[model samples]
Target: MLLLICFYQDQTSLLSYTAAPSPHPSWPPAPGIKLCVFITRLTSRSFLTLSGHGYGVHCCCFSSCGSYLLSCSTDGSTMVWSSDTGEAAAVLQHPSRSALRVCAAAPDSSLLLAGACDGTVALWDFPSKTLRRCHPVSEASVVACCFSPCGQMFVTGCTYGDLKLWDVDMSLLYAQKDAHDLGVTCCSFAPLFQVDGCCVQLRLASCGQDNQLKIWIVSQREGTACTMKLLHTLTSQSAPILSCAFSSEGDLVVGGSVDKSVAIYDANLGTLLHILKQHDRYVTAVALSPTMPWIATGSMDRTVNVWRIGDGDSRTGRKLPGHSGLLLAYWSEVDVQTWLCEEGLEELVSIFKANNIGGAELSQLNKEAARELGIGLAESLGLRGRLLRKIKGLMAEQSGSEAPDEFLCPITRELMKDPVIAADGYSYERESIESWIRGKNKTSPMTNLPLQTSLLTPNRSLKMTITRWKSSQ
Candidate 1:
């Protein structure tokens, strides 16, 4: 059974242009960064801290019904805690493993999987407090893990740039290895997928160092070994991708990156829908709250931030705080995107409009406007000859055109400090600079009257010009 409940974001993003006189723009940053935070120290209270890991929680997930909260740590221990009291319910430890990156419980709440720093996956029965199995992985660190919705299979993200799939029984080769440019950072297997005309099957979703998240379908071709086909490739968030997860509905995907925030995307279409920003640092971890319409994040800042889920408007999402160390995160999926060429194109269009950026010709328009402004200023000033030459040189030195751009005197090659009139017989006096400069124009040797020149030129006939230079002699 799926819930159709929609969590309406009651609060509007303050960064939204709605309040600004700038009028409504478009989607994407439809509102700017709302100047809002999901978690604030003054308002948020600690849930509970499971000591002994020597660090704060990195990743956390709930069972099928929100009965138990499973958490992993950088200190190399995975703990099962009661969702009610935040008390440590069970502690699972591996002596050799030093850091635990991710721990996820199966959708049915029967099994728990942990990806550790030592390149190994640890499976725990939970009820027996016994290790059901432990498998050695390659050199790439296990950055993420999750159980498919059906729990028939599990996958691990290893640094070797591949997603390794294993059957729950651990008997045969479920999936040998898959492709990614850098080490695979995270993997999620869609527990429920339709295959071969109405037959439900399992598929996998993965995120890695390449800054893209991919969807794979397991297909057994005749005369060829069973393989996961690269169904779709997505791009939106900038990398190194920190985390990715699916909403319970599974039609949507959320991911974070070194870019400092998370993005919402059409899962079926690899287009970006919205960008949410709040965390102080890179969003290293994220989790989706299916029932509550919330998404949680842990970052390098040692905090867990819970945000409103869906595209309700980033400003109003309720934020909750958790943890004490640099928060890394793990994520899971709810429903996988259905592959339909038409639907994919529609999604692409929607996301395209959502993150709408103007075309490349915008650069040309800016350049033209700047050129016009310079021409207008030049025509108004009525400057010519050496004066124009000096002004152009000064503008060149400034490098850019701005309202109050710097003007470097062409001869000095230094910024114009105190400009003065250069008419009349050469005269020097210790006096107020502006008044003295003005006095020179009031009376000139040519005519004991004000100069007709518009301060654009000076009568240098009797001027003593002292150009400074180093003499080789």
Candidate 2:
């Protein structure tokens, strides 16, 4: 979850404040021992590299039990490897497809979903060792996929900035929305909870190439389609966010950015909590340990830094040498937080109360104090201007600048400049459909059926209308 530690100049007296406990039964209880001593006793060297993917790895995740690691690569393959040995256990491919970019393992580890550069998602049933289905969900490449905790549904983020929700069978499209302008790079489904009677609450966090991180709440009405409503738009990052993950308890969001920094945010409050700039180059991927208060960050600098976290006494950066192309990182879950609560230094808890920082907003207030001591509050205040500009631009786009639904590309959700009628008797963006045919195969991106021809006929009437609309704007 979101672990808040308030560190003072002493460094030894690290105190932590805990948030409301998660209702998910799958989450393990927190650790019983203090973080500093517990982490110190663990092995210092924990880096392991899976060396089979021919191209750069893009995303990787640990299965719920931590027995296996699933990773997708630019090589167009998704491999299941033994987490302990780093040996490839199975390789998944459609023979015609490669360049798989993202993947997600079901919470029960019974199924796996792999997203490809061609925007197709492959659902695999591991027990039967069979390809269940290949779903063509978008024309632009699929960059991120996350399964719901209950395994009843999944969500995907596409390169064209579309976010879609699909049923467990990958048959029904429950909902769809345009989440970002340029492209949606990453998305994850937070653990669901029951709110009022018969009503469930679901939150989705997504980061995009547009340099925005958004939280959406998904709801459904009887006999109506599922809908996703934007809850918060977090835009404090000065660079594009490439990777994002929700804490096992769904209380925190950790993201890696192109600006050579890793940002940790409070999921409930949508506040940027900490920015760790340990890497020399762009931070491409980030993962939180399932069992401990640790965060693993993979960077373009060819280094994997395992950061030891504390309630109030976080350790300095520690870089570990590993894969030359470290694209993804993931950790298994455990109850480090509960352990600390039971056996941590009681004196530090009293210290936290004395400082008036023991309740909600403890993380935000403490992080701000830390920034005031380390850097100046000026930098933190400066982030607000950037965030405000992004929000204002978003508001303007949402109010009256929205294009007509027909003028938008079905795949990208953005305006379609070059509209063309495909063989499936549907109009699509020329570049989007052509890329799907050439990259994913000759199948229809919208129908996933064999097309009569790859050629696209220009939709002149729609194009003219789009042009006129843009001129009016």
Candidate 3:
């Protein structure tokens, strides 16, 4: 479960990470908002889309200068999209496995990489329109990977706690087995902080299923690789640390958690500084921009939030529409309408029954009438059987109902059903609402972010404060 009020920020060109929380009285804390992976692009704009996948966009990154954008999927596909036109430049597909994570243009412009659940890192050659190659990682899936500043090397972390380094030639150099006691969900190489020439002395940060943040300094010596020691291990008060990233300063580490909160740490000491509790579900992604003063985050709540850092407490300020794709459900008085495209009355009837209304009531069909009333893309059936007439509208009289809308905005108190439409009259159909509930909406513990952080980071250091969205009265 994750949500970002906005994803208009980044780190490669480097301020990174965000969440909901308060800071120590004087440390100039980072602002926080709940929902994982504070999402942000270099530009403060994003297109709301809903037609491609049943799931929300997962991995998003920009080219070196923040020119081109790229994203991949759990549905086994990768899309390179033009930021200017919002059109797909290419779509790379996976076999049975889908990409779990993606690393955008390395310092080199010719290549891109995607980490897959199948324990393989898939590489792309921009010039050739084909999948260039794949390199096996480990028994477990690779969840996170990052490139070094020079683009000379890359590191991949597996869900089973292994971190492996690979040369550009795709040969293994260093493999740290059991990088975490539990699954390792994210990994990054410090940008400016370099090692004493063993390829690179990378500062590595990892978050995991173990509920702790682990940091290590790795370097190569005389053809032998060495790790300095565990720099720090910050244990959480609640759930495991799910996602983590570094700030441009190389001194801050931020992360999202399963506990429904956003946490900030002094990158050097692993000191917990701020926390954000503005979301009601697990935070999925977090992002921050070095040049910009704002932090944006997304969540399973289907909303993106923005905050200011520097206050020990998360000073929440804005919640924006994170998704633009609308699922316009057009309900009509007519009982028989088109929902899918296919032929055959009897077979289509059975198909809808099997797919849409699973385990729904079944009866000997009136074969002749079914042929007369097939549904289409432009039509909708009655919420229930129209034959029942006057008393049928009361849902309590029925056995059960459609899975109750997956989302309910705490602020607007409206059911986020499918098909949001601004109707001819001033009424809007439930498209945006439905997309939020079913698409991005998740059921993790992260949704429970703190609404107030006065007890945490106090008086006036509030970096960015979210305008308290009025909740349901």
How many residue pairs clash in each candidate at the backbone level? Answer: 7, 22, 87
Off by over 4 Å in 3: 1-56, 95-103, 127-130, 195-199, 221-229, 311-473
**Candidate 1 per-residue C-alpha lDDT over 405-434 given as tens digits, one digit per residue, 9 for 90 to 100:** 113221121223343343432232212223
Off by over 4 Å in 2: 1-49, 221-224, 308-473
Evaluate all candidate structures by whole-model CA lDDT and list the values in order. 0.50, 0.62, 0.50
Best by TM-score: 2
Q: Between 2 and 3, whose TM-score is larger?
A: 2
TM-score against native, each model: 0.57, 0.58, 0.56
Error of 1 at 153 (Å): 0.4
Of 1 and 2, the candidate ahead on lDDT is 2
Q: Least lDDT summed over 10 consecutive residues: which range in candidate 1?
A: 13-22
For candidate 2, give the lDDT: 0.62
Per-residue lDDT tens digits for candidate 3, residues 189-286, read 66666656554566777777776777777665656654445687876425656677777667877776655556667878777666665655555566
